[model samples]
Target: MGLIELPAELRLNIYEYFLLRHTRIKGGNQPNNSHLALARVCRTIHIEATPLLHTYISLRTEHQISKFVYHVDASRCNVVTWADVANDGRVMLTPQSSPVSRLFLALRKMTGLKCLRVFDCKSGVRAPDGPRFHGRVILKSEEAMFPDDGAMARSTPIETYKLCVSPTTRSTLFTNIPPTHICTLRLSGDCIFPDASDFSSLRELILDAVTGNHFDRRALDSTFTSSRLETFCYRMGGMGSLELRDSHLESLRTGIGTTIRRLALVGCSRLTGNGLAALFDQLRNLTYLALDMITVRQLQVGFIRVLSPKLELFKFAITNVSYAQPLIAEEVMLCDEIESLIDRDQPPQSMHLKLRDEVLQSSGRWAKWETMVKHRGIDLRTGVWGTEELQ
Candidate 1:
């Protein structure tokens, strides 16, 4: 029997396996030829696969947005559940005739859009129109782009919103969103902290590389305590002027510590091992824990041991050790304990350990730890000094 001669349900499963892979557009400008090729196999297959192809739409440039609006029909537009608008360094906040206005017009047509991400490139972007750009031009332009309150009410509510734009532009953009419907919020770059009252329905909060200068201590504390957040990730980039301290961990412990399942604190150098141990002790319900490039003090083993028994995955990366202090016996024991924890067939199904070359050279026990890590089939990553800086 031919492939098309098979049952409809079986054919749909095969199409989904291939078509679902392209649902998330990850920093790319090119379309997958194989997905497009599969959609063109036959009339029946094309009818079944075309909707899947258009399920997740990513428009990176002004031309792409314009093409999508003009080419995609209403039926295909209705099938789109997620849309990403990444203006790769282009001046989007211009006059009413700008690309952003066109992009919003396209968004209005996507009746099924449940998630929207508006992010920009890290560098190479030009400055705004002028000093008056943000105060007047950008606000006026955004007003024209975003739908009115009545129109937004009629449209499908977006559940997830991810933003990576300049700090000044964040507030104006947020005003357009229906705050009550947003369940997940991901903020990247140097954006200001969000007010908790604005997103009453927020469940998962992710802050990636956000600077601490814009964060208000009182606002952050209230946000954690007030919101019913389930998953929280705060990853700081570089050595900022302000870092998350032990007091912040206290806030987390008192706030959502009992309810949170997954937590990641990367590059939070100010968080001591003792503070983390205290926080982990309170977080009895945590299932996944990731601590990358965090400061490890005397309580290295204590903190790791305090991890919740419900934990399923642990990712830990060691920072560069000073020649003055050298590797202590506790640090070596910490490694041994981690290996034993992974060896057990309990809650933590997977464990990852990252070490610096200098750290391995500082102690021979770490080499033995590396062997044990390999024997236990734990994921291990190693890096040299200055490698991250160059990248």
Candidate 2:
């Protein structure tokens, strides 16, 4: 029998294998030959596979959004479950502009969209006497684009939303949708910290490159205490450090320590050893932990011992080196401490340690450390430490 003559289940599996790859349509003009070929095979197959091909739609420019709004029919638009809007820092959406109004209209037409990501549109233009987000003009006039009774207002609730835009943009965008419907929220760049009432149903919260100054202590405490957050990750880049003090750890421990399963604090150099130890002691449920760019003083054997008991996977990095001490001696002392930890009777299930390449080159004992860890049936990894983009 021919490929199309196979069982319906088998045909669908085959189509999914091929069509899923083209789901994330990037540029406005790029065409998927495979999708087109499959569609051309037969009318029945096309009807079955077209929905899968339109599952994810990514528009990176205003032109792409415009073209998509005008060209794609309602059926294709309705099947998009995930949509990403990442303009190239050029197109500014001013209030009362026809393009801006049309853009919101197009967004409302995606009846099936569950996840939406909007970011990277850092325009320099400023609107006079208009609403602004992170110093960027988001509106040109006072008229509302997404009215309270519009189609977008009554559309399916968004479950996941990632915003890296300005404060005005965020406020304007959320005006139409109920914040309680959001389960996962990822905020980056200069976006303001979300209000306590904004995401009551949030389970996973990711803050990328967000600084400490953005958070209000009362709001932070409210979020940690009120929301049912299970996984929280805070990542910072460059030389900037998040001002996470002992009080923050106290809030985390008292609020979600028992429920949180995965925790990552990267580039939070302001945290002290005592605070980390106390926090880890309470977070007995955590299975995955990532700590990067923490202060060298916090790398104590007691902290490691406290952390090893519960974590299934641990990612640790040493980025804050003490220049007051001899570099080589400091490296040797740190490596020796790690070696001693590996030699312990019971180590973490898996540990990824990131160190300076120069330190690794100078020390020959890392090879022995790896072997010893392996002999103990522990998965140990070592690599050069550096900044990486958070995807």
Candidate 3:
């Protein structure tokens, strides 16, 4: 039998494979010939395959966004579920702009969208004085150009969304978004957003630094504590040490507590070892952990002693790991105070530590760490550690 003469299910599988031929090209006027050929075959095939072609999209410019709506069949947006708008991390700040608003208007038409990411837009004005650097993007209320169709507002199944913005804005862009449809909210800003509690079903939360004078650890805690968040990640930029003490992390136990499975606090420096140990004690089901700043004592307590046996991956991002020698030695050393690292029934499967080439060669610490990681039988992952120039 011919391909189309076969069962309807098998024909659909072929059409799906042909039209959704994987490509990461962000913007273009038309899909490649492979996708076009499938649509041009017959009326029924065109109806079925057109939606599959619009399943994934990445738009960079407002021109691209406008062109997207104009190019694609409005009915084809029925199958579009995942969108990555401007994934490139650049400052897209055009003053007196309405493109972002228009972009939101276009997104409202996609009834089947489940996930969206809008990252690294600069919405801050140039600072008048002091340091000359302003914060990240901040969306205003006027940016809500979404159509007021009650059916469209109530029907979208969009669950996970990420928006990166500045801290000082008086209003937010995603404020009008349907809370019932949103489960994961990734908001990057400097200060604590006052209306975070509005998203009643929010499960996963991410917070990031966007400006100066907004690094209070309590603010990070308050944001995640909005709902029974199952995953929490915080990224701190620019340099400075931070202490995760009672004042900062105490609320975590009562707020998120045993529900959290994945936790990452990256680029922050000098975490108080004991406070982290106490924090570790609460997260008994943690499966993955990533961090940049950690002391030898914290390593001994948190990773060696306190971490759950269910942990599958542990990653350390090295900036200034002068204490790595003791850290490696301590990991290899059998502790009379606690169980041996080798005696674990379900040890982590992978451990990754990314560092500079100079730091790795310093005093043969890298070799020792490799040997220890081998003995522990972990799949070692030192991704692109040798590429960056040493400071």
Candidate 4:
């Protein structure tokens, strides 16, 4: 049937479901093809989903963010409760203008925001301040866009505040965060502790840092302890050397106590086998434990040998190419001869050897290599292999 045959309620429902499936408020950069496609379906759908499009807005360019501010101010949808700028650390601040100011301007206009995540557009790019220096794209206007009490009033009621800035931008922006009305705070940067204000209302906390040494250890411990958070997540970035102390983990463990369920450590280089074992002893209610970039330690001999059976998910990757030789050497040292390696493991009779041969041959090794793991209950030879060889 054509557009006229469908009822208005049905059309609106379709738009709503489309938004539910496609509208990612927390991490999405912008409306996807589904959002754009829904608008093109018909003029009616366009009007219905326009508000959905505005519900979660992301403006990458300074120009786009400005335009969005104007549109929201004029239309006053007030339904756009989530706004994200500086997606994936691409925000640039100019000598005189700043993305944070632009964000401050846009946020002041959106009074209905319940969740806000601000990220630094400039992450790794560092240039000296000059006419041509590449930094966060700041506006040339020196004038404060926000009113005297505007920032405090609008942000006090915000329910969720997420900040993902670089070390530089974090130092400047978090210098004065409106005492948070937010119950959920996800911070991913370096040394960002909003002034020693009480976050008594906060229940969920997530900390992600590429550079861990940037923050003062003692002061951060005090902040985490004071907040009494319920669910806590501490994720190290891809750099792999981010320091995590037993005291911090213990503080986190003690603060959450019986409350924290899921804990994931990503790219942490310093976590030893003994440390993880000790930490696991404290987590009784912990359901999910994930360890990624365990590239720093020997899994088979070190941490995995001591890991808890309660762990639901475990992941590890290579720390560096330099470790590859040691891994191979370790494996080779255990087996005296190639034949000894092959003879050690025997396969069960029920399995087909040809299938095993194909699996082994994929790595450019001879099919006979299967004998190495055969004794470990893997069947490397089946009746089919004998029949084929007799032919």
Per-candidate TM-score against the hidden true structure? 0.74, 0.72, 0.64, 0.60
Candidate 3 residue pairs that clash: 137-165, 137-166, 138-166
> Which residues of candidate 3, in runs, are more than 4 Å off?
1-53, 86-101, 120-142, 145-152, 165-174, 190-192, 212-226, 239-246, 294-303, 318-343, 354-376, 383-391
RMSD of 3: 8.7
> Which has the higher TM-score value, candidate number 2 or candidate number 4?
2
Runs with alpha carbons beyond 4 Å of true place in candidate 2: 1-50, 87-101, 122-152, 165-174, 193-198, 216-219, 238-242, 294-301, 321-347, 356-364, 385-389
What digit string (tens of lDDT, one per residue) describes model 4 on residues 52-81? 666766545566666766765645537777
Pick the winner on TM-score between candidates 3 and 4. 3
Tens digits of lDDT, candidate 1, 1-391: 8879999999888878776565443442323334667777889988987767667776665566677789878998898887766544222343532432356667777888887777553322244566645643233322334645423663688898776454333333354565677788876545543354455677787766555455545545475434666777776654443366787778778764457788887677667778888988988888887776544453345688778888887777766335334344655666766756665656376666675454446657567756766776666544422212100
- Identify the runs in model 1 with alpha carbons over 4 angstroms from their true place: 1-38, 41-45, 87-100, 121-136, 139-147, 165-173, 193-198, 219-221, 239-242, 296-301, 321-330, 343-347, 356-391
Q: Identify the candidate with maximal lDDT.
A: 1
Clashes of each: 0, 4, 3, 27
The most accurate candidate by TM-score is 1
Model 4 RMSD, rounded to 1 decimal: 11.7
lDDT of 2 by residue, 1-391 (tens): 8987899899889888875555433422222234546767888887877667677676655566677779989988888887766533222443532323344556767888888766554332232344553344344211122343343454677898775543333323354455678887776544433354556677887766554354534545465345666787777544443455667777777774456788888777667667788888888777888877555453443455566455677777766655533345555566666666666666667778887776766656767776787698988877743222233
Displacement of residue 232 (Cα, Å) in model 2 is 1.1
Candidates sorted by lDDT, descending order?
Answer: 1, 2, 3, 4
